[model samples]
Target: MAHRTRPLNLAVPALAVLLLALVLAPLAAVGWRGAGLSLGPADWSAVRFSVTQALLSSLFSTLLAIPVARALARRRFPGRGLLITLMGAPFLLPAVVAVLGLLAIFGRSGLLNSALQALSLPPISIYGLHGVVLAHIFLNLPLATRMILQGWLAIPAERIRLAQSLGFGPAETFRHLEAPMLREVLPGVALVIMVVCLTSFAVVITLGGGPKATTIELAIYQAVRFEFDLGRAAALAGVQVAVGAVAALAAWTFARPAGFGAGLDRGLPLSAPGGWRRGADSVALLAATLFLTLPLIAVFLRGLPGLADLPASVLPAASRSVLVALTSAALTTGIALTLALAAASRPRPLIEAAATLPLATSGLVLGTGLFLLIQPFTTPMTLALPITILVNCALSLPYLYRILLPETRALHADYGRLADSLSLTGWPRLRWLVLPRLARPLGFGAGVAAALSMGDLGVIALFAGESQATLPLVVAQLTGAYRMEAAASAALILVTLSFALFWACDAGGRRAAA
Candidate 1:
């Protein structure tokens, strides 16, 4: 039996080591390359802006989501399930696409501005610090709402019954049952959004620029692309790594589990007060739905006309993106599954850390470090796609690992003894036991990874030469050149491809599981 398991044991650690190397090696290169460099005033400004915007974005996203989530938790309106599903779309929506959507509604000549102009009011600018915050909120509010709603759902129905038995009013109910969940969940949600915004590149680059609005990620890009300052870029990357690590650690430390005991799986609903509260909840739902969906509708509507006149570069760029997305999805799924399976058998901090450490590093930071590491030997452009693939895998691995770990652990707990008794080792075990059991999460994770890669505009921008551009890059290029119609067209294609890849992988997994 030991002989049969020896290969599995060895493979787990070997894979862990490779993952650690992938994450740490580039960081080491960054540190070594920027050993003596000091950040200038501009770099300091970038750091400040990054931290400030991230905090503000997180605060607003969490605060705004509370009412929306509470409404969803208690309200059983029609289309409620569909609305919940819609929340996930913005999270998967490409940063470039979301920015374009925002521009369509809020830009100088966009719908809102047009209305203002018709009333003879001054037009608003969707560029600078405020724009950055608005865009972040737009992208992250849904995520915050979803997380909080899950917290609301996880509160055992018995608790709601107890509160109702006591004749608790809405305020009393919130004071006792709901607020505690928010206390437990909000910190984590805010921190997650903060970390996400801290590492934001595409959004900041598109909507927020200049010295006042630039984030560390943007400054790193400027250092590499515009200034050709590798040392400065490395220094900025190191700062980013520090900030990300600190935020991640804070999230882990602060996010305590709610000690709400379990209840029988009853389908009791929370107290949904009527009168003004009902009206308010309806308003919240309506506002949230519009805020989330309008940009997507605008993207479709604007892009519809330009579809027949897409730039020649869009098709080829999209093909490159699909290739990258598929490849990244495969690699991420394989690595995430291995790590999850290994961690399920025992507590492997090294494996777990390797799986998550990428969260503490942005794509541009990884790209910068990789560029520095690779430049001494060859041009970074020569290996752009491969590096992008690797970075996407690293970035996407954490999500898949998180998704798979719980299921993997549950599987092991339920079937490990039986599998061992039967000597279900090697390929047969995986084929008959593991794969069959874990197909759904594996599919969903792969879909997420694919969609994310499809919409990625980060590392590729740093490394891609003209010929190697992806769809997101193509869209950004078109937007940059003031080709709004073409950019919208390419962005629409990018969104379609991303969602399709996600659906295909996810559906395939669901079918296999069935």
Candidate 2:
């Protein structure tokens, strides 16, 4: 027992210490500085606005997902797989690019407005609370649909077979089967979307249009950049974390593993509902596809024309972003593997929590702490890319850990005794057994980390000088300057690079596994 556990004892403690210094210490800095901070009316307003929008965004996203998810589950259309794949595209999408795409369709001279004008009706605005909610819905609806669809898919064929044999109609099947599944799924979906919208900065900053639409994250940025008020920024960070913790706890309490039963390859053959029900499904599917696909098409169309006039800065920024993303992918994968291995060897709550703690800490808040921490020793601008790399590593850890943990446990459970009996331990066991078994998930986690880091705007915005900026930051700068053509071109480049990296890594993993 002593020999078997020795490595884990050392590795787990070391990981915990690293997380403390790198992740927790910085958050503590925020809490420490904001200890005496007090909120004014404006600060309170930001809080109210942040909570209100998040609630509305999550509510709408989850409610809208029910019908869409149900339609996708039962109906096997020609392009069904492609549409499902596209659902995940929004996750890898850079926020700035999404904003540009949305504007092309919803802006004053955009499709809807033009149609309204042609009909002699007043063109509506896309720059207030509704605008923010609209953007959130566009972004999160896919996520909610995917989650609910996963739940639908997990329902056993036997239960479905029973329902069909009992001559249950659509209403009865829904009441008995689908509604229960949704009840199990929607809470977690809402919680996830709520947390995402809670810390949303780029979307609100761009679409918010003014102070009245500001979220807590935007308020923090304002305090730091305009007021130079660390106290106010820290105070807002505190509120953000408090709100995130409450939501997270609620999710943890209510959340169950969505996995119910393994799919048996053959689907449950149920009778299709006809008439208006079918039409409603068709409308839902068509509207969703057009809404999501149009913006991407616009980005490509708008960007193609501007590529010839691309700026010189785009290349350098792209290079820097690639470098940071690669480095962060390596760092995050390494840390997540180490922590996952340690926990798999022997579970420790503190070590596990430390890995996930960053999820609750906003990226801008982490950048702010790092800025304060390193400002005394050297120029923050000089260390901008490195700091960004580190923050990305911290932010990506939780996802990587989630991917690795289950795989690690399964590997150990299956092979631990056998490996020990064969006297295969330490590096050889991991190299031969664990690594081979885990390559696919590891590669997937690395890809996700890479893509996420490639498009991250939070840390870079805080630390970037005029000369040092990532691709996302560069795109945002162009948009701020109203250089729409140049911005669209840069966004295309950003999206391409992000997707390419993810594809290469994910495909490589599949090849290795095969």
lDDT, each prediction: 0.92, 0.85
Stretches off by above 4 angstroms in model 2 are: 1-8, 257-270
lDDT of 1 by residue, 1-514 (tens): 8998899899888998898888899999888888889999989999999999999999999999998998999999789999999989987899999999999999877899999999999999989989999999999999999999888988998898889999999999999998888888899999989989999989998988898999999998989998899999998899899999999899888766677877788656798899999999999999999898888888899999999988999999999999999999999999999889889978998898899888889899989999999998999999999999999999999999999999999999999999999999888999999999999999999999999999998999999988999999999989878788889999999999999999999999999999
386-487: candidate 2 lDDT, tens digit per residue = 999999999899999999999988887898889878888678887888788998998899999999999898978877887888999998888778787798
TM-score of 2: 0.95
RMSD of each candidate relative to the true structure: 1.2, 2.2
Model 1 has an lDDT value of 0.92
